[model samples]
Target: MDTLLANITYAGGAVYIFYILTAIWIIAKKNLKLLSIIFPILALLEGLFIDWRWGRIQDYGENAQIVLGALPSFIISIGLPFIGFYIHHFITQNLPKDPMIDSLIEKSKSGAFGNDDYPSIYSLLESKIFEKSSYQKAIQNVENQKELINKMIAVLTDKKDDWDWKFNMFNEYKVVFTLYGTGGSYDPDNGTITLLTNKSGGFMNYKNPANTIIHEITHMGMEYSLVRKYNLPHGLKERLVDTLVYLMFKEDLPDYRIQQMGDPKINDDLKSANDLESLNSIVSKFVNK
Candidate 1:
């Protein structure tokens, strides 16, 4: 009888070790469904095995002693899996949804922008109090500005399907051109792209506005997918956006401009590479697939 009990205890211990190793493997691979199934099995097996082994111990042979000592461990082991499952469920439930993209799709469905209309660009006039007429005058070159806008649209929409869904969401979305210092920005909250007209010495000065416009729009798209959808960290989000932009516009834009879009930490050589394979390898470290 003692030998039979010993064998049972040994087998249980072996199973427990296997469960621990499997749990680690599943966790490392982020196999959440498998983890959900395995953890409960682990708890059940642990409780049974631990109870049987403890039952054979002379100190825990008495019913009162067994209830006092063994019951707590069994309860704890069983409760742990329940707690783990709850945490897993809570995290998955609370994962971020892209509010920006959701709003854009809803706005599109409601016909906020006309069916055939594309995204609009508007010049933000400076407040009368801070009247700077030069900035206002820069945007007045309507014919030249239209030419630049059309060229940018052509470059960005070459493979229309790549961005058609996102662009459709922003049919009414506006790019607010401003003479507010250097660099452009996108506001996910309002679905607006604010381009710094002063960056290349205002609208008339841009040799190619497509470079900057594409960069800012890339940010807008990534914010919807990566930032809002996946809830990626800021550093990883920037890396992915820069890598994608580099891939898309490598032919049209200068190497330096592409490098400027990437994370400053990335080696300049890698960021400026003409090949997509090298660039993708760098981006894959932060984002799988």
Candidate 2:
């Protein structure tokens, strides 16, 4: 039926418009100048073609007419997404700018996650790179082992049944992977662990990311509570995570190589399993020392 065909075409056009807008926003955020210009032009041309084709559908009922009858429909669908590109140009070319803002716009264009200079987990995991290829396959392993990984973290951290509650986690924990970065990075707010998927002589055995997941999840539990509370430096935080993980999961995760990344000064004080029982108070005692 022409009516049904028109309906389907209309829906498809709506989806295409939504997708282009989302893409334009990303291009703007990522500061891809060429793509910003190209995408909107492409979207506009495609939208016009689609509108013309839809007009060809015979007996396209009153509903289609109301939506697609006027040139305004084409403008609304194609013009909105292009706004981000214009706004980006305005900010960079016309407005007062600083080094920090410039750095954010330019450095973000790299979109590469480096181990030492890691960005937010949101940026890394939300990246399109891991959507396919070796990284995608490796991330799947992490997902499958996520439940067991969280349980291991709960036990080693001694929170067990009340782990989420104890950590004050508001969301169900998530696990994802990045092809680069530290063995793992934790986003406490999102309760996510992004593991590096380089299995070539790297820590996470890509076949099984359980050890890496447990390590980062352990960080999530402490990040807000103990790490922030003590104002522990990055080195100290890494050291503390490993200390707890090793103390609790040494046998279960024999393959896990403790990176020993943190303040060496406090090493002798945190080697005992008994230390896991009163971790917070002990950390406070040693940290203030």
Leading candidate by lDDT: 2
Instruction: Give a tens-digit lDDT track for model 2, residues 134-161.
Output: 4434544544554566456445434533
Kindly list the per-residue Cα lDDT of model 1 for residues 88-143, writing each as its tens digit: 53322111123432343345455453323222101111111112342343334322
**Candidate No. with top TM-score:** 2
Measured on C-alpha atoms, candidate 1 has an lDDT of 0.40
Error of 2 at 140 (Å): 4.1
Candidate 2, pairs of clashing residues: 235-262
* TM-score, model 1 to reference: 0.38
Q: Model 1: which residue pairs collide?
A: none
